[model samples]
Target: MLREFHVHDRKALLDAATQQGWDPLPAEELDEDDLHDVVGAVMWLADSGAEAEGADGLLDLGKARRLRSDEGHEVAQWSPEPIMEDFGKGWLHRASDQPGDSDQSEERTDFAALFAAEPLHCDDPECEDEGCLWQLTPRTADLLHTALTVLADEAYDDAEELGDKRLLEGEHEGNWGVFARMPKLTFAADLQWRRRFARAADDLADDLEHDRWPQPTCTAEELALHFALDDARDLHDELGYEDDADHTALPE
Candidate 1:
């Protein structure tokens, strides 16, 4: 039925299914919907430039041509694109292995000093009076932000696994509280950030009506710092830390 329907790129469809850990149905056994889904998946994978070589090598041209001809559809040929460039291809290779200047190392050390000197703070009002806000540091803030980003990305992956119907729930206390207490405010902040980062991308996608970039107003560093403080407050509330761990290391 799939072959008869002339579903474009049937082999590629089967290949994608195999790559996804699913046993590809024999061409003779596939129904229309199955074939349609396979074709759609293949097209999606190809468009995303995913590297998945299933049963056939990349771009199985023979199968593609047959499917397109059978379906009376235009067969678009896949081109081999250069993924990267070698700067020294046409130039002489400098053999001197002298290490580059240590400017970046010095700058990193200075940045670390600045980070260490900054006061840490908790977001909770109660903690503020007791100087509990000083429990979070710049490094911790970076870690917290990275963790949240990873969590969010995982949620997105889960949503995809569930067929894209999942409404992601914020797992972090800071994000959840802000989202629940002031959804509009949170949304506005997100929008503002997106607008800042998206200006350059928006220009590139001028021809596209719906192209958008993630908001990038506030520095990720700042967001991470705030997130860590908020998370630390939530932790304080939940864990009820001893005075030693919670206060001695915390800056006044």
Candidate 2:
């Protein structure tokens, strides 16, 4: 019959072993007697704080354990990358750099040339008229950066919708069908770029309202609201909202 060891038995066994100056038995060799002895030794060592060098070392070990557990959990919970798989391994590198492909490189070069050749109008009305808002503002840039980041994050889901919508419309479509149907990330980038442009317009409106620029008939607040409404109307029309044609367009 296997004997059960209790707290009193453990304490007594540990005390007897200590008195006899005998080393504790290994875990595999442990019966009721050994378990009692080990538990007593553990409890005594815990109370004395003599199991390790110092309290700081034990605290540090606890912190390390917690950090490692957190990191492991994060790794385990990681979601698969969405758009990266769709675009292929070389797509990002190729899209950004256009390396090795003369045709794509030339296209990028042409776009740069076109952008440079076009009249670079600051979206800020004040900047456009007087060039006062041209100085780079960190606050403005940070706001734009945050907005762009959010837009980029949302673009993957939008891109999926675009792809799925297109696929459903077609009778015969394959995996490549999704790719062919979706608007390019370039298109989403352009949309985000337009929003940044709108933000610049808004900043200019703010400056005007604050009397930073030449006097205007309407208060800056009024003009800003008007432009914002116009933007909303434009977006509504673009998104195919069914409204009277006259109601959606800006007044002449």
Candidate 3:
């Protein structure tokens, strides 16, 4: 009957199977609707740059599910996620032993020293109480930021397993609360240190322009690094994770 109906009037057959009728329950004849949805989903995946099949030459349902889920979620909310190429090529490559690193090490000394120095302190003559913030340099700040960001953004499966272990150990704190704070703090501190690096970069640039440093304090690579850090800092801000005005580290 279905084949005959399809041969004569395919559109009428599809409507009869999928569209609402007096019956509340789905008609047993509605396999056509399921087939229609599956076919439509496959077409959408193809249009969205998704691979149609896996290595085994079978349709990849896992990818289809993920794409559908992401599309639904994105309609409600969106986030700026780290791109794999950006993380691997730009940030990780610089930190690893690459050809540019030899010169990078030598040039980074001055900025590294500045980064390693004690944090902001009160030097006011009128003030009786002197204070200091976290002893975080730009290098250390970058490390902490990268670690926490990866933990929150990429390593959720590992984090979930770790949470289970913590629960077994009788940890009173919920994993969600415990895991959430570090990324927030590190993100704030990264922005704070970016400003410091930018100022130092400007100072170094001025010194180089005026021939003040017979031995330049920072190399071109280090200056480039400072600007890169600044760009990352600005990106976080644009993503709506506003930098903490206090610029103080959260207690561990």
Question: Lowest summed-lDDT stretch of 10 residues in model 3?
Answer: 58-67
lDDT of each: 0.38, 0.36, 0.35
Candidate No. with top TM-score: 1
What TM-score does prediction 2 earn? 0.20
Q: Which residue pairs collide, candidate 3?
A: none
Please give, for residues 42-105, the per-residue lDDT of candidate 1 as tens digits: 5445545564344233212110112223335443445365344553454342444224423232
lDDT of 2 by residue, 212-235 (tens): 431234443233334444444445
Write down the TM-score for model 3: 0.22
Which of candidates 1 and 2 reaches a greater lDDT?
Answer: 1
What's the TM-score of each model vs. the native? 0.26, 0.20, 0.22
RMSD of each: 18.8, 26.0, 20.8
Model 3: per-residue Cα lDDT over 1-252, one tens digit each: 000001234343334333322122334545755644434333333434443331112212110111133235342344476333332342233445443334343332233333445534676545544345345454444333333333223223334344333222224244433233333432223322333333344444344333233132554325434443544465444443245322223221
- Candidate 1 yields a Cα-based lDDT of 0.38
- lDDT: worst 10-residue window of model 1: 58-67
